[model samples]
Target: MSWSDRRHLLRVLVPGLLAASLSGCGFQPMLAPGSPGAALSGRVLVDAPTDRAAFDLVDRLEQRLGRAETPAYRLSYSINLREQGLGVTPEGATTRYNLDGSITYALREIGGDAIVASGRVESFTSWSATGSTLSTLGAEEDARQRLMQILADQIVTRLLAAAP
Candidate 1:
């Protein structure tokens, strides 16, 4: 076979081979029916938000895990955030800032006190401060929102991995 024909054949054959191997190994999507993720979906009740940051986190968690109507598990989390200057101008003015965030979460059976899964996830986002006061404030808020989303995604991934 010519080089072009061989290349085209390989492109199709490789994916078919990969799919066959994956199925033979019992590989299935995490969110597929009867999977751990499917079992946990819409079954976790996240703690109520107490502030804007908490609200963002809860919103994302709900978006990922679905809102529980009859909850089997309760997820409680605490968000800790810190801001540090990352870039400085020649005159010692802060030009960029980093928002470091961490969430400590625990999942427990709704009516029981024993913890089922617990973990802490950390992430960071940055925003530019070299702008007008209003623009700087907006950038900082955007960074905070992104940080919360990152932390929430981590929480959901961990919960899915730990689901029974």
Candidate 2:
């Protein structure tokens, strides 16, 4: 067959083959309205946040997974945070810092002793400390919130990927 002919043949045939394979495998979109993972919405109760970073993390998770009206599952999480000086001035003053955050989470069916899923997620954000003290404090708080959002999103993505 000519190159053009083979190109045309593949364009027509590949999609049909993919459709046939997928149709037989019972594939369904995880986050779709009626899919299995959709049932998680409004059904997971996140443990109460103990601090500001935890509060931000729970807020983002609830934004993604929906708040529990009548919880069928429990999400328990613990957060660890560290501040590391990133850049130092020639005079030995810290000019930049990184806020590193990690969260360990577990999901379990309500009233059950077994864990359905569990893992840890880590992220970091940097802030410049060269500015005024108030400005630097604001930047650090913003970085902390951003890190929480990132980690929470990662946890939700993992949950959706593993949802059946």
Candidate 3:
């Protein structure tokens, strides 16, 4: 091939390579299956210290976790999900019109002060406004949902970390 042809080929090939390389990322949005909530029945538990978080956790777990599983293998350890707050903030100066608080939680399989699978995540919920970009309750919900999934994974990591 001529030098010009080789240059042209490289130009075309580079973009194709770039596109393919960028296409495959683990990040993806999950599609819901008719329902809007989930239940717990397997090894995971959302037993909160307070009633409010417990109820909220229940809804979130059901909403995000999908459904409960009455598994045969009893989980050797129990992981707890606790929250720090239940609200969202826009920037820092301005607050949402709706209620705005914070929620922080961790997954810990407590035995001799041992943290099994644990992580801390936060979310924001607000009825700031329809056109208002700040305090988007929808975005807060999304963050909260994903945080639970991450917590589940952290639990697995803790399990593996404890393994001999």
TM-score for each of the candidates: 0.96, 0.82, 0.33
- What C-alpha lDDT, on a 0 to 100 scale, does residue 123 get in candidate 1? 99
Ranking by TM-score: 1, 2, 3
Candidate 1 per-residue C-alpha lDDT over 1-164 given as tens digits, one digit per residue, 9 for 90 to 100: 89999999999999999999999999987778999888778989999999999999999999999999879999999999999998988999999999999999999999999999999999999999888999999999999999999999999898888888
**lDDT value, candidate 3, whole model:** 0.42
Candidate 2, residues 16-128: lDDT per residue as tens digits? 99999998999877777898788788888999988898899999999999999989889999999999998998999999999888889999999996788899989899999
TM-score of 2: 0.82
RMSD of 1: 1.0
At residue 63, give the lDDT of candidate 2.
99
Residue 5, model 2: lDDT of: 100
Error of 3 at 9 (Å): 23
Per-model lDDT: 0.94, 0.91, 0.42
TM-score of 1: 0.96
Is 1 or 3 the stronger prediction by TM-score?
1
> Native-vs-model 1 lDDT?
0.94
Cα lDDT for residue 88, candidate 3 = 44
Cα lDDT tens digits for candidate 3, 52-93: 433444555544433435421222223343333333456544
Residue 4 C-alpha lDDT in model 3: 100
Clashes of each: 0, 0, 11
Segments in model 3 whose C-alpha atoms lie over 4 Å from true places: 1-41, 66-98, 110-113, 128-164
Output the number of the lDDT-best candidate.
1
